[model samples]
Target: MNLRMKIATGAIALVSAGLMTFLGTWEGNGQNVVYADNLARGLPTVCKGVTKHTSPVPVVVGEYWSDARCAEVEKLVVQKGQLTLADCLTNQQISQNTFDALSSHAHNVGTANTCASRAVGLINAGRIADGCRALAWAPDGKPVWAYVTDAQGRKVFVPGLYNRRRAEAEMCLK
Candidate 1:
């Protein structure tokens, strides 16, 4: 592989079916409904977790869309997210599964934060397995980032986030 081969020019599937399906399964593929995202302080979300920040167009709480429209917007959101993820990643070739897993991770954590995370740094240092492990665990082998701040500012572990991170880490390792 060329040394400069990045996701844009490499064989990394930017919007592969596998990624779409994985996102749909985890993000909830509602046909045509917009609702508040409890995980995000009740941000308005629609069509497989498309939020105002991620959507190309404006997202309203009660906005309605057709099934095709939902898919289209979701695709656009995913492409934008994957492209941002590619930009954040090092200019080295990676497996489609790893790229997809990282893209999903980035989608959840925001690209800027994900780019600055220990996982990305480990991957850039060529410790791929360690990078994957860092997605869910700290260097001391304790789980991390699986919590939500409650209204009282208490850290509450979200089982769903834990499961999702574990799955993403497994996919990255593969």
Candidate 2:
């Protein structure tokens, strides 16, 4: 079946491997314990970037999760993110690469924000390349979703996030 059909029928049974690879490359292997996400205002995260906001399991600071547990949580999180992306992109046909790229972006920045962003809007409007570009930068030349609050409460651009977004954008173009 085609991407649109699978999305429309909710028949995409599993998260795409590309998304798993993307998350692994960006979020790193499950830390095996919760650590403060410095980029997210010190949000406690574990297991391939699973945080309180995103994890199916409860997340506690300093809590340990074995590799098996981390893999479970990561799978669940990625599946959930895929559902969110599918919902947001309803009726829109996209490549698996595009879906994986957007899923990773949504997983990082929050699905709600991603769904409402110019990227989604552009994609829904059939401007696939424009949407991909929006993942890296806004039309105003500002980095999109690449800033994090520093300890001093100043917004600082994170090169890692910028690079990730650029990579995701490039993936979508492939």
Candidate 3:
């Protein structure tokens, strides 16, 4: 097979796997009394719950959004600004200038031990970006930017997910 064909085959496999796992998780988690919707999206890591805060936490991070966290970001954007105040936080430093930098920096990695605390730590320690790229990414295993409609069907303009999803692909059309 040619290089392009090989790469295309690999991507189809990844999307299939991700979609299957996502579907199964939705089926498993959806039956609960809480989740408002099923068929929700999954990120690179579907970490277990975050450990309790131990203090001196520079910032909290996680691999995937709690179904609730997704909803909260959605609510704030609709009520307040394009991006929520919480969206501005990053391990690098919390400053007005940092917001734009955040999206350029984030990339997701799937972890069995997923959790918000770990996610934040990865973001802070710079592991999230480094580790994701370090993984055995095929030409296709990059993350996709989702419209991320929330419970109210509003789009949360999360810059990090947007950029990472785009950058992970061919990187640039040019």
Clashing pairs in 3: 44-110, 47-114, 48-114, 60-120, 61-116, 61-119, 61-120, 62-119, 62-120
Q: Root-mean-square deviation of each candidate, in angstroms?
A: 1.9, 2.3, 18.0
TM-score against native, each model: 0.92, 0.90, 0.22
Error of 1 at 27 (Å): 0.4
| TM accuracy, model 2 | 0.90
Put down candidate 1 lDDT per residue, 2-63, tens digits, no spaces.
Answer: 32255546567667898888888788776477888887888898877788999888888888
Better lDDT candidate (2, 3): 2
**Candidate 3 lDDT by residue in tens digits, 1-174:** 422233245421212233223323322332212222222332111221111121111113333455565334323322222122133334433222122122122212222122232333444465545423322232366433334566687876555444543443212111
Give the clash total for candidate 1: 0
Q: Quick one: ranking by TM-score, best first?
A: 1, 2, 3
Question: Which candidate would rank higher by TM-score, 1 or 3?
Answer: 1
The candidates, ranked best first by lDDT, are 2, 1, 3
Q: Count the backbone clashes (under 3 Å) in each candidate.
A: 0, 0, 9
